[model samples]
Target: MTRYYRVLSSIIVFTMMGIGSFVLSKSFAEDEQNRKGQPIKSREQQESKASNNDLAKFMRGKLDASSQILDGLCTEDFRKIISGASKLQELSAAESWRVSTDVMYRQHSAELRGAVKDLLNAASKKNLDGAALAWTRTTLSCIECHKWVRATLISKG
Candidate 1:
């Protein structure tokens, strides 16, 4: 087990070195950008940028894998989306869904859950089309929720 321990120690050392290099490079880049009078993005702005970048990357990956412009999604994905919705609510961009008279938010939530079930079934049967359709449905749920939120959830202002 001496060899195993040595291998593990080497891996740990290498990982730390890699991380240190990344941090040093990033710091240098930021400093250079600062020297150029480039305004540094605030934490919130950076987060928003990263979120958009991640979504775009997800979309691109989906397209490359499916050979189509895929509306890649799933139930857990909707859960994350709704979590972001909650964040918006807390940020005063949206209020409670209770404001909507038509109950669109509830319907959207149900649709997402239903799509998840459908996707699970498709996966069990090894049906790619069904799974992709269901995935798209999850994104649809977010759209539905957003529509209602936009329609009814008013700004705190």
Candidate 2:
């Protein structure tokens, strides 16, 4: 029963991640369309648009790393888990990951880093249960951070 519960939980977490990815992709497409509809009147605007595109590309990389982790979790592939977690950690340290200078954003980033570290540790130990738990924490951190980002953007707008 405990094993069954663990598997069920993992399935649920992966499903949620997939759905979130789909929604985020749709949102990005819509935002891109909206930006395209606007005329860029200045060099600054063009530079800003380029920066946004770069950030979007960086975010896609993060999503890809996350998907790799999910695939590893499902397949019980410790090497893949380690590889994905390492990529995530590296990405988190990159400048692109610092999207906001806000304290809360920093806190969220720290939480994510911690979760990824936990994931790496669990994977290294070949502890599937621990890794799954860490993955769940990682996912929650991402969701919380994204919510904060969206709220902050809306408020600024």
Candidate 3:
């Protein structure tokens, strides 16, 4: 009975040691892979990175147009306002804008275009207050889209 007990204890100890080694080795391999800077990326991650690069110019144009719109509003320059809003509208319809067929993306795009249209109408009617309101709506739409883009594209999670 004493011999049998010793054999069973040795078997248990060896089995546990083997399991521990396996666990440790797997952890080390993952750490080594990370150190090598070759971490695997999911399909979504790859797509997000691709879209970010493709849309960089469109985003810059949006930023410039927004700035021009703000300057135009402050100076009461109808031409500047129209030009900025028109540029925004044109950018929205550009081929690059079709990066995604998402409904949320489409909604935001339409909202931006509509805001620009409102600004155009205000400018044509010489309605300063309407133009101001339309500008606010346009700004909000930009903010919302930016927030969504960051959450979906830039975030690792």
Candidate 4:
């Protein structure tokens, strides 16, 4: 039963990750298409474009770190798991991660930090089961936070 549960959990996590990745890729493609259709930019537009580019780069780094964690989980590589978790913690502390001053946004950030802590603890103990569970939690936190961010942006607009 324990083994069955673990396998099921892993499948669910992977499915969620796949869906998230697909959505993100589609959104990026749409953004690129829109940019291509735009006319020449003014000074302010150019600055905004630069800022958006930086944010996109930062987000890609976060996704890479998350992928590392997934890889580690699959291979039972504790070192990779720890390294990835640490990278996530560091990224979460960056100025760019704090995209909003809203209370719910801060709560979401805190949830991610808590999930990362759990992941690190599991990795330190070399507990693959625990680490896998923590990874799922971490991924869910990220998905929820991103959903909230997108909703907030749409509402603001």
Best by TM-score, which number?
A: 4
Over 1-157, each residue of candidate 1 has an lDDT whose tens digit, in order, gives 9999999999999999999999999999989988998477899888977866865564354234322213223332433433332332232222222334455656765675576566656655656677677667755775777676666664431
Superposed model 2: Cα runs more than 4 Å off? 1-41
Tens-place lDDT digits, model 3, residues 13-40: 9999999999999999999988998557
> Which of the two, 2 or 3, has more TM-score?
2
lDDT of 2 by residue, 1-157 (tens): 9999999999999999999999999999989988888864699888988989999899888899999999999999999999999999999999888888999999999999999999999999999999999999999999999999899955896
CA shift of 114, model 2, Å:
0.2
What TM-score should be assigned to candidate 4? Answer: 0.74
List ranges where model 4 is wrong by over 4 Å. 1-35
Off by over 4 Å in 1: 1-102, 155-157
Please report the candidate that would top lDDT against the real structure.
2
- Model 1 poorest ten-residue lDDT run: 88-97
User: Would you give me the overall lDDT of model 1?
Assistant: 0.57
Candidate ranking (TM-score, best to worst) = 4, 2, 3, 1
Give candidate 2's TM-score.
0.73
Better of 2 and 4 by TM-score: 4
- lDDT score of model 2? 0.94
On a 0 to 100 scale, what is the lDDT of residue 128 in model 2?
A: 97
- Each candidate: RMSD to true structure? 15.0, 21.0, 12.8, 21.0
Candidate 4 lDDT tens digits, 38-126: 77789998998898899889888889999999999999999999999999999999999877889999999999999999999999999
